[model samples]
Target: MSATEVKLFGKWTYEDVMLSDLSLVDYIAVNKAAQSFLPHTQGRYQMRRFRKALCPIVERLCCSIMMHGRNNGKKLMAVRIVKHAFEIIHLLTDKNPIQVFVDAVKNGGPREDSTRVGSAGVVRRQAVDVSPLRRVNQAIYLICTGARNSAFRNIKSISECLADEIMNAAKESSNSDLAAQLAVSAATFQRMIAQDAWKFLKYMWVNSVASDIPPLTHPWAWGLPVTASLTFSQGYAIKKKACFAAKVSFLHRINEHVLEEFYKDYRVDDAAMHVGESAARVILLH
Candidate 1:
């Protein structure tokens, strides 16, 4: 298992909020406000996590309001107030609904003044076109989180497959003078392997991170490219370094399930063998 690389697009800032002071009712109200901004169709997919995770933060904020309303005469304990405050901030700052739900579980459910929303329809919904960029981002997130769908993994694998397909086509083509056929030089092809390999691997790495996986550190955790260039002295070193960088980036985005899978997929024995044979040879010989 290698360190997951953190990419600029996936980074987020963390905020601190207290969770203790909020009562259940306050959370419901805040959720209502946030829900109003989301489109109907999108809301359908988002509400569950929001309700589960963010409601407590609202409750805490409401408690603070109530305390202030009482003219500061009644003192709320710092532990409760601070706890709920953090919860509120956490809910507000969280961009991903799934992450929000996970946070809620860690914080425990809503506090007193509970007002449950029935039928899920209480939240307004809206329609919005999903963009290609958004889809790509989501795919990256899913992979970092270590999602288990084989089909999804296969889809991510397409980039690597395409690169190989193109290279093979170039090699087999008989007409060297064919002007329409783009010529990919050996250096260009190696560069493509170096760049695209990391891209595809990073997506997989990020998915593992998002799922809370510990990350794969073993050198052989992922299958090695069979290309001759990849097995060469400099080529192997580059690949290993790329993998190592990716692993570090991934840890910042860790999710529980992803961590579990990392341990399962990457074994110490395999890693040792691959690193000794591939990485050591590359570094030593080059």
Candidate 2:
């Protein structure tokens, strides 16, 4: 089998040492002294990528090395003779724990990422959050890198499910006004994710470098008079503007996964777009 025999012979191990008693200034110095050993892309272990992909540890170890040591004020005292020199020679190195594990469980321990299976039959468990886009306080991280990438592909599937959700919510409520608003929102979302998306991509390609296009922010106030929004022309303009912004961001990091058919998909629906516009205004007026 694999080498499972433990050969322990070292007098001392270079490991993460947390000194709770260390003064703030000394702590800062110690942290700086050993910071070079912290792994970056260049100094990574050959097994690191493999470890990130295959190692089945859920919780990362929080390790910090002693920084400030020896007698020029602060809590500077260590191994009698070589205290100062000892700190400089050994750099503190450990797995950097992400906030995902920090908030994962009340008492955090090792865990696995079930969803992150790499192509080489390894599971990437380190520095990855299981919940990519969980809504926090109902505020969406509009610029989440992983979430935004996945959303581009999966939004169509999600919008289809939302139609059923709208119907269920409508059935539960006696409020026709609420039902109407939900219907408008659902229709808007459906048009957003499905039909208009392909057309918008073409618009983006045409206006890729157009400085006149405004950045995509919350155009319609989801707060006061929630239904108040733009007409078909206005809605289309804003959507097209947002599409331009998104494409620009995607361009910086484009890969084979990004859709390459922008110039080809020119056919667009005019009638449905008009219908959506009409419906939106109707909801706002009532």
Task: Output the number of the lDDT-best candidate.
Answer: 1
Q: Per-residue lDDT for 1-286 in model 2, tens only?
A: 2243211111222233233322221312223223322222122223543232111111011111112233222212212212222222222212212111112111111111213335676643222222211211011111112122333457443222222222222233222123233333334434434434545544554655535433445433222222336577766665554443344333333333333443235232333233344434433443
Top candidate, metric TM-score: 2
Q: CA shift at 89, candidate 1, in angstroms?
A: 50
The residue pairs in collision within model 2 are: 30-67, 30-68, 58-111, 59-110, 70-76
Each model's lDDT comes to: 0.32, 0.29
Question: How far out, in Å, is residue 170 in model 2?
Answer: 19
Which 10 residues in a row give candidate 2 its minimum summed lDDT? 56-65
TM-score of each: 0.15, 0.17
* lDDT by residue (tens digit), candidate 1, 174-248: 321221111112122223233333354366664442444434454443444435545577566656654554444
